[model samples]
Structure formats: structure tokens, C-alpha cells
Target: MDCYKKSNIEDLKAKNSYKIDLLDYSLFITFFPQLIAGPIVHHKEMMPQFHSLLNKEKALINWEFMAKGLFIFSIGLFKKVFIADSFAAWANAGFTLAQNGGTLNIFEAWVTSLSYTFQLYFDFSGYCDMAIGLALFFGIVLPINFNSPYKALNIADFWRRWHITLGRFLKDYLYIPLGGNRVSKIINLRNLFIVAFLSGVWHGAGWGFVIWGSLHAIAMVSHRIYSFLAIGKSFLNSKIYKIFAWLLTFNFLNIAWVFFRSENLSGAINILKAMFGITWVELPYKFKASWLFREIGGNDKMVGFILISFIICLCFRNSIQMLDNFKPNIKNSIIIMLFLYIALIMIGVTPYTEFIYFNF
Candidate 1:
């Protein structure tokens, strides 16, 4: 509402000074492609484009743009249908096992957390890609939302990469309005906490969500303090130090995901207990020989998949990067079409699964 009001006021001020059509203004607010899960378009960015005569003409019959949009959309569909949905079952099973009085062993705990981590990432990022691609088909360029967030070495860096539009909205509408860094350090910390807490609550209704948000808040505050003290400056500059920092940030994110995925506070605590080796059980030989072996085998596959995803996220170019350097060639088109074919087949076989961010 605040963002809307601010934009509305600015638009009215501009209208009084210069001529602008109402249809363009309406389209700027109701742009269909980005309406579902936003890259949060701003009026200034969108309004000018609506007035572009060249863009309007090009959008009607741009074969090159259409091909690029299709390619990007195919990748997103593959990510959501083939990869994210594959992990959903494993994640659900792990969490359900814990809730059903089954002991959540260390392996199960990690598997559940990791599955959900990848699931959420691919699911949300996939949607973002599709939205951006759709917008491009209409000659509209929405802001990039995901930028290989798993590669981030610190919590602060993670926020910058992940759900970038939402972060921008919060920074502009909440943090800045709350005095931001213009105030004393203590007040700045207060603003951070409030924003984080609201962010958590905005995700869902639960104490686990609050705790997840609080965990991030605490991490951000600690990072700020560390920066102020200039602690371990030399270490921070080293490659080895960056690897350690990435590990720490990634693990912290996984831990918070446990809370986010859990049904309740106790459910989250139980998973955390299993993760930390505070829960244990001994199964009979027959049971261990049969079900335990199968479970371990499944977990091994999941671990392999997670590691592959991590590599892709950390070492390879993201969708946006690929799109930027894209060249439409026969070989590339064939590969993309093949992937899209597989994704369509998978979609046929799998039951429909909603993107994780829909609830938010």
C-alpha cells in the first residue's frame, strides 16, 4: 500500500506537469506477466515502455524475441517439473516420518533439509524465469529476481541475490522509511530486526516462521557488528576463508529452512534435535536389513542430486547470464527442445504441484 501510494503520488505529479494516457498508467499497474509472483515492477520503469511506439510494434511480430522467451520458459519448466518436484516427495517423506513418531535420524534430518532447500530454490527461481521470459515476449523487461543465491558467501550477500525484488521492496518501503542506517547503530539494528520479523510473518503463520526470521535477523546483526569491529579482515580476504564462510552461510540457511518447512515449532525442534544428534533409535536387524538399506540408498541419490545442484549454482552461469549471452543456433535449439520434451513428459507423469511461493 505504501509503495502504491508513493508511486501514485509521483505519477499524479508527473501527469500535472506533462501529458500521459490513463491506459498506459493502468497497464503499468496490471501487467499480467509479473502479477502472479512479481519481479515487482515500478511505475517509472514500466510507464515509459508502454509509451514506446517501437516496442509496441516489435512485440507484435518479433520472432527472435519469441524464440528467446520460449527457450527461457522451457528451462524454467524443466527446473520446476523435473528437478523441484522430484525432491518434493523425499522432503515430504522425511518430514512426515518425524511427525509420525518415527525417529528422524541424522541422515533423514539432513536429507529433508537439503531436499527442501533445493526444492524451494528451483521452484521459486523457476517461476521467476518464466515470468521474466513471458515479459520479454511482450518486449517488457522485468527485474531479475534470482542470481545463484546458493553461491553467496555471507548472509548479507545471500539476501542480495535471493528474492531480490522482495528485498528491494522491503529496503525501500520498510527499512529506509524506518530511518535505515542514517540513525545510530542500535536503531539501525532495531530496524533490521523489525524488517526481518515482518518478513518471517509475511511468509506464513507460525512460531517456526518467526524463529526462522529471527535466526536471519541475529545473523545479520552479528555480521554488521563483525564489520564494525573489522574482525578477521585478513582472513576474510582469503579464498579458504570464503569457502568456510559459504559453508557457514549455507548451513545456517538449511537450518532455518527446517523451521520454515515444519508444521509447528515442536516439529522443527524434533528435526533440529535429530540433526544435532540429540535423537536416536535402534531398529531390529530384519527392519534394518530391509527398510534401512533402501532408505540409505534413496538418501545417497538425494545427496548426489543436491551436490550436483550446488555445483551448478556455485560454478555455472545462471539463467539470466545464459540469456544475456544467448545465440540462436541449430545445436542450441536442439538441446533446448530435447530438454523441453523431457520436461513435458515428466509433467504428464507427475501430479500437479504448486510452486512454494504461492502460499506466500
Candidate 2:
């Protein structure tokens, strides 16, 4: 909070408004629902809203938006519980075993990586959807959280799309403050490293996260170098480039998750070693359903649920678009009924997991 307040003050000072009380930003930070998980609301976006809230009449509950919010929230809950929780188990197990220097094949490593990736996406995005839905019920338009980031063509574009608010916040508050791209070459390098280090720390209190942030900064800087040399632009516009970018982005994110998931620096090192096939010992048993239950983080049912849920999430945007355009006829009724049935099944079968973003 102090760092953020200092940053805010520095921003103000730059504009010759150093007289502003630092405590004035408290409301921006302490908005109850968003204090933990944030589509990190910026001072520029939030300050005006806070002033408006002061003069505002009591917010009326609009039943229509409330109902819609409930419906969306229900779906998000199901996704987090039924799907994301399942994958969380698998990812956790794989990570644990890998840390112990137990045997891990390429298939297992990649599957675990993919599972962690989807688990994060579902866990975070589900919460975001619920927050946005609830905000809409209260006549607020909360910012979008996750777009189809997997579809981005480059790392630069990927940052813009994924965790849109964080990227914007860092750009406005940290990056630009450190001279952005306008300073001397040496200063720019220093600022980039500083912002990335801060970004890592912002995510959590660990050096592993710091390394993860540094990796991303290095990637960004590398991309800039390539751009300056006019190397990848035309090629990057090609389909092959898009494919490579997607692969790179996903794998980069997956590797970072090892750091995010690990207990400490040594744990991160162990996981990274396993990822590189450095483990020399074999586990006592093979990867069977029963063995998975005994040794892994979660059950077969949970794994199945997560895999299926991920498939649905991958197609969710299309599903929502269909819902918006489809006419209210017999087909619609049948679809709604099916959805309701699935929701009920989820409620019965799934074990709940708190949304991952809650930590942030």
C-alpha cells in the first residue's frame, strides 16, 4: 500500500499537484469486492467514480440485470468448482511429484503445464465474469478481464489482451513513470528491469516470481530488439508467425506457472529441472486412475471434470454469442433446460475451489 501510495504521489508530483493528500487514494484501493482480486482499477478510472459515489443516490437493484448476474455467476461458480478445481489437482500433483525428482515424461510435463494453464484461465476468468456480472447488476461497467489471449499474434499484443487492467496499470503507473521508451538506451533498460521486478513482487512475496517477471521483461526487450532491426514484423504477420507466437506465449506462461506454484526458490528449481527431464529416478507406480488418486493431488472424477470444463471454456465465447443471437423458440427452451440440468449436475458433483485471482 505504501509503495502504491508513493507511486501515486510521484505521479501527482510530476503533474505539479504534490499538495494532494496521499490518503485520498485509499478509496481507490479499498473498494471492498476488488481489494483482493482486481481488474486493477487505475486512479484515473477510479477517482471520478469515487466522487460520483459520494453524490449518488442509493443504487437501485434492477431485477433484470440481477437475474442475469445470478445466471452468469452460477455458470462461473460451476466453472471454478467443477472444472478449474479438477485441473488444479492434476497440476498440483504433477508439480509435487516433479519436485521430489520422481520420473516425469514429456507427455506428463506438457499435460501438467496445459492443465495449470487452463486452471489459471478458468479460475481467474470465472471470478472476473462473476465480478463483472455483479457490477452490472449494480449499474457499473467493470472492465473486461480475460479476452481470447490464446489467440494473440505476439507477446506485445498478448500483454494488451491478457490481464488488460494490470498491463494498463503497469504501463501508466510504473513503465511510463520510469521513462517508458523515451529515455536514453541505458536508462530504458534499467527502467524495464525495475518495472518487471516490481511486477513480480506485486504478484507475490517471492524471488521466484521476481525471476518470472524478469523473464517476461527479457522477452519484451528481445521482441523490441527484433522490431528495431525490422526482423520479425512481416514474418510475424504470417500464419506461421502467429502459430509460433501462440506456442511461445503459452509455453512461456506455463514455465512461469512453475515459479508461481512452487513453495520457494529451491522448489522452483526442482520443478524446472524436472521440466527439462533432469529427474533420474522412477516413481514406484505408473499413471493409472487409482494411482493418480493415491499419489496425485485429486481424483479421476476431478480430472475428467476439469478436462471437460476446459473444452467448454475454450468454446465459451461462441456459446455466449449464440445465446445472444438465438431466438426464443422451442430450440432455445431445450437448450436452456439442458444448461439447467448441467448446472444441477455440477452442483451435485463438483468440489469447490476458490477463484485463483482472490490471492492477487
Candidate 3:
């Protein structure tokens, strides 16, 4: 907007730009698929599509796109209602315990942290999937937003995979404007830190969010330094080294999520304490949440779900992959129908839970 408002006619022509009518600008801003949460699309990406659609193209909806969009939307609904919300209960109970000054056993603490971790993965992945699907319904293809970020072997790679469009926006707008990697190493690192810090603030206005950003910044900067030094570059190809690297990255993200999920600093510390083997059985308000898995009568179901979900997150083909390999057969149609039917039933039967990004 500033570019259009401030640029002279010559500058506008150079970029193949012109003033946008208010109606089209509003359409761009209010595109329902990404209005709330987004893939952070650019004007160039959206405007041309809008112009084409308005010029007698809007009526020509591609049946193939509509079918694929519904399929993707159904898959996303299952991810949110069935998978993400299933974990939300455990995560919420654990955080509530800490917030109320209740303590937790080490097992409970780990459960809480890991619950939120997986919950977040599925929740956001579902939202972006739905956004992409909905856009497809209108014959518009939004960018890929999430891409198995938990499978990343390093913090930098995590950013590359997770919330991909947001990362792209930051890299192009903030990181580059702050000099990007072309600058001196120190300044480059500083730019990196600034991008991460603003990313934290973007999530919410809280100290815990700031700390979450700081933890990520530290890890990213450390990784950058490691890469700069080129330590063990040759050994990095070994299976053992790769496994060690993956473990380090995954565990770091899991721990960092405690701060992100906590209601306050003290709550985060208690969970961290228990996670690291400090049992919380002695606190004044001991964490006695028999309801933690009351419906299931134990943590067995939760544990199994976490493991299976983790494996799926790590090993299964993502939605895009499935879509690419899609074949319209009786089996595929039946699966999609089952997902939609189950999701609709859940929506009608269960209490509503907001999407995680709703807070953001």
C-alpha cells in the first residue's frame, strides 16, 4: 500500500503496477479462505487472480478443483476435531494444574508438554490445509504453509518447514530489510534475532512469548554459528550424527513449547522442572487430576495416540503428497466420505474448541 501511495508514476510502471480500486482491494483483504489465519499472500499473487476472476471467469468454477478442495477440507476437519482436540485435553489439564499452583509428577509433566507439542502441530497443519482447500474451491491456489516441520533436523530447517509463508514474509520483508545474510556475520545474526523476536511478539503480548522467541533465536543463532564454523560438516552424513541432530532439534522445540503454552513464568518453570525430573508431589497444591484421562480411565490411550500421531507426523505422506498421488476410485471416495461424516458428527456431538491460531 505504501509502495502504491508513495511511488511516482514511473516507479509504478516499472513494477507493472497501478492504483487499485477500493472494491478489489477490499476483496483481496477479505478473501475468506485466509482472512483470519493466513499463508501471508502478497498483492502480486492475489491481485492478478482477482482481476481474472472478475472478467467473466468467476462463473467458470473448475469441477476438479472443487472436488479436490472438498477432499482437502475434509482431511483438515479430521485433523482438527479428531486429532488435535484429542490432545488438547491433556495439554489443557496440565497447564491448568501449574497455573493453579498444583504440582505434577515427571510423567505428567512430560505428557503435558508433549501433548501441546503434537496438538500444535496438528492444529496449525489442519488450519493451513483448510485454507488451501477453501482457496482451491474458488479456483485459487494458496501457497503451501506447513510441511512436516517436526521432522526438521535443525532450528533453521524447522523454520523452513513450519509456518512456511510466515517465514517467507519475514525473510523477504524484515530479514532482508535488516540486511539479510549478505551483511557481516554479527549483523546477520542480529537480523536473525530481530526477525525471531518480532515473530514472538506477533504470537501475543506476553513475557512467555518473548522467552519462546529468545529460546528459538538462541538455537537458530547457535546453528548459524555452527554452520559458519563448518564443524563436523563431513561427519554430518553419518546415520548416527543425523539421528543425534534430529533428537536435539525435536527435544529443543518440545521444551521451548512449555513457555509458549504456559499462562505465566512460574507455570512454565514448574512444568520445566518436572520435565527435567523434578517431581512436584510435594507442592502445596499437588497435581491430582484424576480427570486427566478420566474418559479413557488411564494415560494408556493418550500415550498410544501420541506415539502413533508422532510416527504419522514423522513418516506419513502429507496432504499435498496424497493429493499429488490422488486417484478417484471407490476406495478413495469412501475414505473421504468417512472423514467428512466423522468430522460432522464430532462437530455436532462435542463441545466446540477454537482453533489454536484463533488466539493469534
Candidate 4:
């Protein structure tokens, strides 16, 4: 509370504002739309809007903004209901198999990891979009939380794009306060480890989470070291190098996610063993005959869905980008409504599941 007050006062001072009543401050802090799992808004970004006459008028009646908000909300609903939930079953099954001391084949390992990847992305990003849309209905603009993080070329770039507000908070509060990059190389490395370790622990209380965070810290430190080397500098501008870097980063993140999703270190290791083909090359006949492998024609649908989702994630403009040129028209309205209808149907048919980050 003191920190928020201090920051708010500093922001107001910078803007040459003298007074903010308790009511306004209370409303700003307790805004329902982003109260949980925030795309953390600062006072400077929000407080002035409350004082603006235009926003005051829009709050009463704004048909265009309403339509836009509905469209965005529908998209988020579709992502959560249709996309994220679809993967949850498969993800759970695979993780369960690993937890039971069953060794997964390469195919099963990849499917499980990739399923959770897409599931987590769509689930969290979907919720963020819904929060943003709800806030927009009241003429409040929240910051964009998720970009195309899967398309990021490096770990640092990934952090910049994924859970952007959390990243910003950590950098501003934790990293900088710990003497970020202002000291010797050894000190900077220590700072990076501390931040990553805390970030891991923040997600959950488990050795798996700790290891996941440590893996990322090591990757980040290695990337930094590589950036300073002559060989890394020489390839900095190469297209092929950029492609390789992206692939490496993407795969590393996927691998690290095993730890994040697993119940323990053993489960994570089991998945990793299968992932790298250290377990077995061929599936057992009985296992192949089981419903798990035979269902849906042996994971073709899963692979196809994953491929399509990856393509869409890689090629499509993110929600924020789409909003940049947004103008609601009759055609777009119909499209959005159709999607909303389908999403509603899916929600009715599928069992209710909590958003993944709600656990965090």
C-alpha cells in the first residue's frame, strides 16, 4: 500500500497534479476488471482517464466501444473454451502416464509437452484479453500482456513478450534494485540467478519449479555470454543464425515447461527421457493396442491441431495488433457474433475448468 501510494504521488507530481481524492484512488486500486492476475496498471496510465471529460461521457453510452469490447471478449472466450480446454485432456493423460512410472515414447513425449505449451498460452492469454476487454467497456485501456511469445527468437525476447506486465514489474522492482547490470559481470550474473530463482518460486512451491527457473537462468546467462563472444558477434546479423536461435529458444522453453507442469522432478525427468528418445524407440504391442494409443487414430488429430495452432501463433497478428486498426462494422460484427455463439456452445458442452494461472 505504501509503495502504491508513493508511486501514485510521484506520478501525480510528474504530471503536475496536486490532489486526488480518496474515492478516485480507491476506485483505481480496486477496479474489478483487472483485480486478479493483473496486467498491472500504474496510476499514470489510468488515473488521468478518470478525470477526463471525454471518458466521463463515453462511460454513459459508447456503442462502438461496446461492440469492440464484445468482439475482444468473444475471442478470449473462444480461446479459453475451444482451444485451451481441448488440449487439457491430452495434457493431463500424458502427465498422468509419466507419473505412473510409464515411459513415454518420443511421440507421446512431444505431444504432452506441446499440448501443455499451447494450453498454457491460450489459457493465460485468453484471460488477459477478457480482462482487457472488460476494462475497455468502461473506457479504461489496460496494457497488452501477451504478444506472440512463441515466436520470440531468444529468452530475453521471450520475457519481453510473455506476461509483459510481470516482466516489467520484476525488472523495475527486483532486478534494478539488485544493481542490475550496474556492477561487475559476476554481480550481474548473481542478480540474474536471484531474479530467476524467485520467479520460479513465485509460480509454485516445488523442486520442479525451482529447477525450471534455474534452467532459464542458465539459458539467459549463457545467451548473455554468447552475445559477448566473437563467434556470436559474427553471426548476429545472419538470417540462418537467427532461425537457429529461434528454434533453440523455442525448444528449450518447451523442455523447461515439463518441469513447470509436472508434479515432481521424477515426472519431469521421465518426460525428458522420452523426449530425447532415451527410453525406448518402439511402442510395445499391448500399449499400442490400448485405447490410449488407438483413440482418435493414434494422435493424428493432436499433431494436426498442434501444428495448426503453432502456425496460427507464428503467423497471426496478436490481439493488441488487431486492435490497432479496429473499427467495428456490420461484417465484423456478424463474424464476432458467430464466433461468440460457437464459444458459448463449447462452454456448455465442455466441463468447467479454471484458468491455469488461477493456481498461481
Candidate 5:
């Protein structure tokens, strides 16, 4: 339920401190439901909805949308509780160990990296799902965020599918305006690099992020060349090429995750070095299974849970597509009820954080 507002600050600058109209902006930012994490809302999306709410002279009160919203919210809750947070606890421990260095094992680093990757995805995407669901509950549709990004065959495709709103903002507000692909080849490459570097900074104010962005830019450019040479002029509709593309894309993204997950360039370097058999050492402390379950509420018994949730999340093209295939009778009813029960169980647990994207 992310919402954005156009600031009136431009007009008020002359007055230095003009009285502000808090209604629309407040509604946009502090709309109780989406006040936490967001779809990274834009000014273009919020104003119209705010005006519509005001014109109708009512707050949200539609039951059908509300029910669907509740269901989606519940599903998001399960993803956060049953999946993301659980992974986060373990991943955080692994990341903490990685940060300490000198006592990190290669196996540990790999596990932690993979765990963090899962935690990052589910944590962020679960929040986005909740946001989208909440928005729809109010009869507004927020942009979709995750679309099996793990399956993407290139950085460009991954960007198109993952964190789509942020990608849109970067492209619209940053990339295109910075002479995107319209100049000489050298300038175009420079612009792409500049846009990517800025995008990394936008993700975080650190050198690690900068490197992450740079790596992505390089990967994207390489993929563009590959696409032009391989897919663009090819008459072969071969499955082998498709598989190769997917393999290349996934590996590139996985490699970049080192920088994205690292606390700093040194940490990323150490991890990369470890990947190349630099060294391995035991941690001063051992990880605990009990702590893991206790922290996330002692329900890791079912491996099927994670696999099923991921399958459901990944297999569907979009929510509309999911709903289209959904049976409205006993099957759908059962699924909805099961989701509701799981959501309630999760709610009974300890506190939870909002999606990871709020920082952006």
C-alpha cells in the first residue's frame, strides 16, 4: 500500500516557510496501512487516489476489496513469518560471522551467502506483496515487485522483474534523463555506468553498494552485447540457448550478491577470495539449531513449507494470473482459510519488521 505525494515545496521556497497543506501529503506518507515499508510509491500514483478519496467524501470501506486485501495480507504475513524472518535469523548470524572475519569457514560463508540471498528476497518481496495486497484492499493497485527474479536470464531482465518500482524510478528519474542510450556509443556506455553507480548509491551510501552497482552495469552491458550477438540475429529457438541465458543470469546475480550482502568492500573481497580457496577457519562460536527455531518460533520441521511457498510465489506470472486460475469453490476456500489460520499463528509470535525496501 505504498503511496507518494508531490511536494509543494517548490512553490513554498519563495516564502521560506509557508503554511503547509498536510492533508494529501500526510495521507500519502502516513496512511496507517502502508506507513511502514512500501512499493516505493511515486508522486504520480498518490495524488489521483487521494483526490478520489476526498471526492467520494469517504475513507476506504469496500468489503470485497477489503476481503481480498485481508487474504493477500495474510499470505504476506506467512511469507514474512514462516519464511523471511526465519531465514533472516540464520542469515544474520552468518553475516555477523563474515563481518568478524579470520574465523570464517568457506562452507559457513557459502551457507550464509545463500541464506542471506533467500532472506533478502523473501524479506523484501514479502513486504512488497503485503503492500500490493493492502493497496488492492483499498481498490488501488500498486506495481508488482518480484517476478521469479531468480529465474531471470540477465541483469536487465532481473531489473525488469525485481523491485520493479524502484527500477522504474531509476530509469524514469535518473537513467533516461542522463542521456540514456541516445548519445555516442562511448557516451552511452558512460551514461549506463553513471546511472548504475548512482543506483547503487541510492541502494546504500557505501562503497560496497557502488561496487555492486558497477558490477551490475558491467553485467548488463555484457548481456546486451550477448543478446545482440546471440539472441537477436539467431534463427535458433533452441532450449539450450534459453538454458544458457538463465544459467548466466542467475550466476551473475548470485556473484553480485556478495557485494550487495557484504558490509564493505573488504568483506566482499574476503568472500570472493574465500570462493577462490584463499582460506577457511572455524568460527569461535558454533551455530545453534535450538536458537534458530526459538527465535523464529520452533517450526522448521517441514522442509516442504519453504519449497511450497517458493513454488507458489515463483510459478505464478502475477497475482492476477494467480487469481484467474484460483477456484472460487471448495479449493479456493480451503486455501484462503489455511492462509488465515497460518497468519493468525504468526501474529501470535513476537515482533516483526517491515519489508527491507523501506530504506530505499
Candidate 6:
């Protein structure tokens, strides 16, 4: 890739690209911070950093970078263990039930879907944050892979913010090669669906993934149509309309995550059946394990934590946004230490789980 990029330079004279040594290649391949899941990097992004490492090693001792990296890492750890894991407890149970053909009421189904929705949001974002913080520790700045995707008002906007590096890769390498938007609108829409299907295949070999991808393809296609249509051209001036749009997008995503997380298509549909109230079960069915707070805690604790998670996801600035304003200070150090300590204690060598993307 580096050689190709250099070869394409318009200049008549340019520095020739050298072959990377085997050891350097191996190091980059095994860069532990982002090996499993990535802000998928290219050689151009990393090689320069590696080549200049010795020159920068001395200056790397600057306190600000170290403090900032630790601060972000601490927050990521806290997010994964203290928050994502808490949500995972319910998500795992809910999915397990669905996979096993257990029936669910409206209450149970919503809980299950919403739990997995937030679980994936926090889990993947937390992993990306940890990766970024770790790379920063070594004076390597990774590409931002996640933003506050939940805050997006439309499917297109959500896609722009979610799994950003993956979207970038797909757009650059796949979509563009398929002719992108340079072609007729119909062909462009077709190209999008192709990319979406391939994106699902890239995740794993599952029909559920295919459906998940297809549903999103339909969504994006509809969004495009809406943008081009006469009715959609007219302004929706009221805040109510904006709120409605956000709600619609958010609920669509929450529902789509069912297929993304489910073990099988049938399991996903079963959950969806309950979600759509096809199986309403209005009489408040109670099992030995009620859906609301299954294995975690009391109803109040579940409600409180979930509400808090929503506030953080919907209202607070994301970690990356906060990182921009991070100034190393005694107060910041104390908070970082506290967060780190709790995460470490909670994990205690046998973590409740690993990062979900490691499977991908």
C-alpha cells in the first residue's frame, strides 16, 4: 500500500519506498493494542511512527501525554467492566432464552433488545477507547472508531459515527471501486446494498448477519429515497418532528441489533415478535427469573443503572470529546486512579467477559 501510494505521486522525482523488514512487519501485525479489533490501520499510518520511535523516545516522557493516555484508559476500563459488563449480564441471558425458544412478553422482549443495544454500544466503544488510550501511551495516535452514535437523528448520521474506521475502509476500498455515487442513482443504491451484504459477511457467516445487513441496506435506501422525495423535501420545522425522527432512528437501530446479536434468525424473529407486540402477553407473567432484573439486582437498581446509562449515552459528551479538553491535574489524576482501581477490582483476573468484537 505504501509503495503504491508513493508510486502514484505526481512528482517526477520522489524518495523511493523501501521494503519493510520482517521484524518490523511482525511488530505491526502483532501490535497488541489493536490486533484483534481495530481502528483498521494502513501501513502509511503506522510505519512513520515506528521508524521515528527512537528519535521520539526521549521526548515521550512528557507528563501530559502520559496523564491523558492514562485518563482515557481508565475511563475505557471503567466503561467496559463497570458499565458494559453490567448490561451484558442481562443481554446474555435474554439472548440465551431467545435462542432456546423461550417465550417472551413485551416487557421481556424490550428489556432484552434494549439491553443488547446498549451492551454493544458500550462494549465496542469501550474497546475502541481502550485501544486509542493504549496506542497514545506509546505516542501512536489511532483513528477514532466510534462517536456517540446513539445521538444521531437519522440512519445515515448514525452510520457516519458508528464503526467509523470500518465505514471509511468500506467507502474507500469497496464502495468507490464499485463506482459509488458517480453512477446513476439506481446503480448507486445497488452498490450500497452490495457493500452492506459484504459488510455482514465480513462480520461472520450467519443468516442473522445477512438479515441484519439487509435490514440496514433497506433503511439506508429508504433514507435516500426520503431525501429525494417531494414530501420529504418540505421542511419539518417543529422540534416535535426532530424528536420523532430521532426516536424512529433509535428504535430502528435497537430493533436491528436483535438480528446482529441473535444466534439464529428464528431467535431474532421470536424476540421481534414480542417486541412488535404480536405476542403481547398482557397479564404480567412471572417466571422464577423475571425479565426486568434477571441476574443483576433489584428492579430499582436495574432501572436506575439503565436510566443513568441513557443519560450518559444521550446527554453527556463522549470520551473522545472530553479528551480534547483533558488537562492533567491533581483532580484528574485522582479520578483516573479511582476509576482504574474499581475496574481492576471488578475484573480480578477472571473477567465477566472479553470485548465482543474479539469474536469478529
For lDDT, the strongest prediction is 3
Looking at candidate 1, the ten consecutive residues that score lowest on lDDT are 1-10
In candidate 1, stretches whose alpha carbon ends up further than 4 angstroms from where it belongs are: 1-22, 53-59, 283-300
Error of 2 at 194 (Å): 2.3
Output the lDDT of residue 264, model 4.
Answer: 72
Error of 1 at 342 (Å): 1.5
What is candidate 6's lDDT per residue for 1-360, written digit by digit as tens? 111133332221232254688987997898888888887877666766665574574365546667777888888888998888887877777778778887676666787788888888888888888888898788666777788999988888998999988998999999999999899989888988888777888899899888888888888888887877776424565678889998999999999899999998888988899878886555334543344445322255556667898899999999888788788888888999999999998798435798899888
Instruction: Give the alpha-carbon lDDT of every model.
Output: 0.78, 0.63, 0.82, 0.80, 0.64, 0.79
Runs of candidate 2 with Cα error greater than 4 angstroms are: 1-31, 43-59, 232-234, 281-348
Q: What's model 2's lDDT at 232? A: 55
TM-score, model 6 to reference: 0.88
TM-score of each: 0.88, 0.75, 0.89, 0.88, 0.78, 0.88
lDDT of 5 by residue, 1-360 (tens): 222112432322233332336775676677655556666666445556555565685466765556566666666766777677666665666555556663345544554565566677777777776776777677665556667787676678888888777787888888788888787766777777777677788788877788888888887666566655644435345677778877777667766888887776777776666655576544335345333233222234323444554466556554434543544456666777897787667767845755566665
Count clashes in each candidate, considering only residues at least 3 apart in sequence or on different chains.
Answer: 0, 0, 0, 0, 1, 0
lDDT score of residue 346 within candidate 3? 80
| Colliding pairs, model 2 | none
Q: Write the per-residue lDDT of candidate 1 for residues 1-360, one digit (tens) a residue.
A: 121234643653364433557876777768888887787766765665455534473356556667777788888888899889988878887777766656666766787788889999999999888887787687666677888999998898999999988898899999999999999999998998888878888787788888888988888888887777846777779999998999999999999999888887677777789888898754335543234424433545566778888887889999888887667789879978987999999999998999888877
Clashing pairs in 1: none
Better of 1 and 5 by lDDT: 1
TM-score of candidate 2 relative to the true fold: 0.75
Candidate 6 lDDT: 0.79
Worst 10 residues of 4 by lDDT: 288-297
Looking at model 5, residue 56 earns an lDDT score of 86
On TM-score, the candidate that comes out on top is: 3
- Which has the higher TM-score value, candidate number 2 or candidate number 3? 3
